[model samples]
Target: MEKFTLELLFHIIGIGAASGLIYKDNSLFVIGDNSGFLYEYHIDSQDLKRHPLIENPSENILKKEKPDFEALTHFQDSLYIFGSGSTPKRNAMVEFDLAQKKKTDTKNLTNLYEVMQNFSSIKPEDFNIEGVIFEGENWYFFNRGNGISNKNTLFKLHAKKLDQEFSMTSIDYKLPKIKGVRTSFTDAVLVDNKIYFLATAEDTQSTYHDGEVLGSIIGRIDIETMKIDFTKKISDSHKFEGLTVYKNDNKTIELLLCEDKDTEILETTIYKLSLNLK
Candidate 1:
């Protein structure tokens, strides 16, 4: 593994609790955990635009009533936003049309989530999903181990088939610990058959509440081997929950990350991380 460096890119005000990020065509698309708006930040112009995803007068929803959208991924012309599935109310998937700039479809993943919980033997209180990866016909959901179960697992299923009879493949991963605190999956992206993920170590063991963050790490898993290739601590202060590849080449890989400060502040900081591959 090569040494990684971090740099401050910019900040997006009023987009607090930024949880999911995707960058394409020089525009950064972001979704917050507590907000009902999709934000687009243009890199060249430095302009920010917000598109409402729900009917809200204040543009932000109450914390207790929010959908808790924690993961974002796009397929073809639509961007899929998924709830954390920590509670009964957070079991929805919102599909936003990228071209139309509006919501196109919605799905309730309650049955699927319940089945995963049962198969994984994870208690209801410990079943928080924080990340998702959509590649070809497979969909991989990353379940955080922040709760009592402490089982960082990856669930894979056929994306085109959602019937109840379809079986899901469950794979467990033991993330490295930071300062004696176990790290849990936050977000992931698949590139060239390699899966890169972000994991954070928080102080608390409950998935419903926030805790003092110990640190965050970046790791990789090769699809062919299905094993952890490497893991390295990225930050000891910022609790990053969203990750996207900003740029990649033969020598280095640049990633863009969004931080969850666990506060009521109306701003989010975007960081640029560069990893030397040589």
Candidate 2:
């Protein structure tokens, strides 16, 4: 793995905290951590549309009252959005139908999240789930090491069911530090057998509070071995939290990333990251 190039694509107006991203059919689906709407940005036309994920008003949702959607993934024909589960108020899973362009169902993941907390022995304050991806009959949940414990972990859950009988295995990782702050997982995308993930170095010991951004890192984990192949620093100014693959070839991979400035600004920028795969 080698250094990657990044380009500013365009700005997504009115979305302050773009935490999750997914690209499909020439459009980008964005989820804001402090918003009640799911946004669709057309790449070719430069048009943006907002679909309400819940009954509340889209952008007016308060920060403390928002669902804090931190991860997004497309499976089958629907999009699954998950909360960070850092707090009791952030334990919701929303399923949006792609064809219908509406939220079909929302699941309260309190039980499932509690099970994870108990199994990993992570305190409620340290259990911040920042990313999730699925392959075959397994779903991988990423726990950010931004809290007091600073434990970055990957929880693999067998997809038999989301009940007490389901099996789970965890792997802990120690990410590189940036500007004296250790980086932690923020988002991930699975390409073939390799999982590409984003980690950001924020100067905060509490999960509920915002902090100074040190930088962001991109890394790859080999699924077969469940180990990291490489980690690279992509940016030293922006705290990118969302990532999705736009295109990939034999020598290069094109990815789109979204960032949370940790401010009240009502706009977010989408960046293009090109990785050299040779």
Candidate 3:
């Protein structure tokens, strides 16, 4: 149990954040935003420098009217961007090549348009994809779960083969009901083989009407047992939207929490948390 200290802040509104420490000895991170822009940031001099990655070409080309960058993850030297709205022709995970600096292709795993046309329980508009994390051979997607009900849902998508069509299945997990908690699950990370997620919760009935005040907490998910232990709570104004684990010199683990200041018009901040992994 430890508190996070803010390291650096960048005023960028990103829907989701993804980072990877690869063999190049360079730390890479990608931030996807509502404006259909993906900005790549490199860690240098203890600051984040925005490097242009990719952006949606035109609104007319997209299926839905508004294409939001909801989820992001890195796999096989490529970054995957997922969302509900995308170009009508390709409305799934858009793969971006890190070395080429361009979008290679798109994969429509859910067939959102077709799913909405036929299904009743799910709809294209109801899909609010947020953050993604790779665990084992499967990639878990965290959905904001329909802005109406705000039900937290995790979708497991198999991505063992890049060219293979991914099959998605839902997993069960209960969102914490804390007083003044407004937002649902935002981001997840694996630490010591355990999954920990960060979410924002605020009072919907508050008179202040200042949007949702950000709060954070950590929960561990047992993969084998299919159980979530949310006993640890983190209360901070920084709204955590992404997390990454790093090893220190002494072989200790440090969790890097990324904050999404989308609504507040604040700078994006990253916090480092020293954890006691026992």
In terms of TM-score, which candidate is strongest? 2
TM-score of each: 0.96, 0.96, 0.71
Candidate order (TM-score):
2, 1, 3
Error in Å for residue 149 of model 1:
1.2
TM-score of 3: 0.71
lDDT of 1 at 251: 85
Q: What does each candidate score in C-alpha RMSD? A: 1.5, 1.4, 5.6
* Predicted candidate 2 versus true structure: per-residue lDDT over 169-228, tens digit per residue: 999999999999999999999999999999999999977898999999999999999999
What is candidate 3's lDDT per residue for 90-163, written digit by digit as tens?
24667777787677876665554344323324334444556677654887766554244554667666767445
Q: After superposition, how far is residue 248 of candidate 2 from its true place, in Å?
A: 0.6
Give lDDT per model, in order.
0.87, 0.89, 0.53
On lDDT, the stronger of 2 and 3 is 2
Clashing pairs in 2: none
Clashes of 1: 0
lDDT at 113 for candidate 3? 36
Give the range where candidate 2 is weakest over 10 consecutive residues by summed lDDT.
158-167
Report the CA-based lDDT of candidate 1 relative to the real structure.
0.87
Q: Can you give the lDDT of residue 59 in candidate 1? A: 42
Model 3 residue 83 lDDT? 58
